[model samples]
Target: MQIIKAVYINEMFKISKKKKICTSLIFLLLSVIVAAIVVYSLNNFAGVSVTGSSEFSVMVLTILSYSLFPLFTAFICIDMFAGEFADHTIKFTLTGPASRLNVFLGKILAIATFIASNLIVVAVLSFLFSLFLNGGISNPLRIIISYIMAFLPIFIFALTVVLISNFSRGTTSAFMFSIFVFLVFVGLSVAFPQIKSFLFTSSFDWYKLILGSYINVGKIFRIFLILLGYGLMLFAAGYYLFEKKDI
Candidate 1:
């Protein structure tokens, strides 16, 4: 436990030193600014007042979940695994006192922490901006729940990226492969809606279940189980490869 904590802290420190983290923050701020502009235009020009706090946050989350979040996860996972391998820096980590399993868990936890932080920042920033535009939020609890629930699916996606990164020899290959796999699954879900519920990609919108007027506990539990299955399988597979790698 102590080793894992140490590794987690160390990994986070390493991630903090990366420029991508700053870039992600800048992109998020820009996205919020652009969203605010569009909302302003619609309200003034189109005469549509859709500047509700909850609604604004949802719109921003929709744009992010479908695009930025997944891409950022892929980039971070690639940097944590594939890029380390390419740079021959993974050896330093592997030579530490921590066991391979502990190291793996720490790294995964670090990525998850980063994702959660990003979600929090987006939620807070959007909510503050929404307050400026709309004066108050309608359902602050619902928006908070939505953002909290969102972490699961995105972390599952991160597990998928971690699995891909383990098998990739370079960051470029890892990123391309991750995007390809993501797009393929998304396409499959679109073409075959029947199986959409089972795909982790489709579950990215699982927050809708909570945000709905009537929350279906049973349905939410069923989807949670499916996502949990995917997360476990991906983690196991990723760790197996990580353990076997000649770092």
Candidate 2:
């Protein structure tokens, strides 16, 4: 299992590299770097100068966990599963020593690795640099918790993209369609905030789960369980389709 997992990870990165996706991955890295720079440079709030560092840190992490990092990752990963079929490698690869479940888990882990690592890097870099944000609590525990909290939303998102990829079978079009579908979903959900709790975006507010103080953490966990259940259902559906699919 370990060896196959390693090979799977290598193959995943190799695919990313060959597709020139690694270059784009720099944006994820750069976002973190930029956040750290912003936090360190303008800790004094520039003009207002009244809002404390905690406020700024919260704002920065919120943006990172919510809009910026997630949307960017969504773009990068929308093709994850479809790309395999696009390249005509799904059969040869999945029927190997790896089980279908392993394949799904492996692909998920690969995507999660990139997302989680980027979040961690951003959190650590921003946390260390946030020291300049005078009132920012340098509590290491909070920072760790913050990074862990960031992963939930990413997992929910990556799985969504992966599941969506099962429909199109081509990386480029699947990716494009996934984004279109996402926009439509967002638009409808926003138009009716009364039912917002049912939308993935509403539940994806992990930054609020940690950075904000109003919501109960238990509710956040419940939302995560819902997302996980959705992810598993998508994976099962995708796997069934793949098992009977003509490649």
RMSD each, Å:
1.3, 3.3
Question: In lDDT terms, which candidate is top?
Answer: 1
Off by over 4 Å in 1: 49-54
Give the count of colliding residue pairs in each prediction. Answer: 0, 0
Q: For residues 113-209, write the lDDT of model 1, one tens digit per residue.
A: 9999999999999999788777778788988989998999999999999999998878998999999999999999999999999899898888878
Off by over 4 Å in 2: 2-7, 12-21, 33-45, 49-57, 66-68, 75-79, 135-140, 210-215
Clashing pairs in 2: none
lDDT of each: 0.90, 0.64
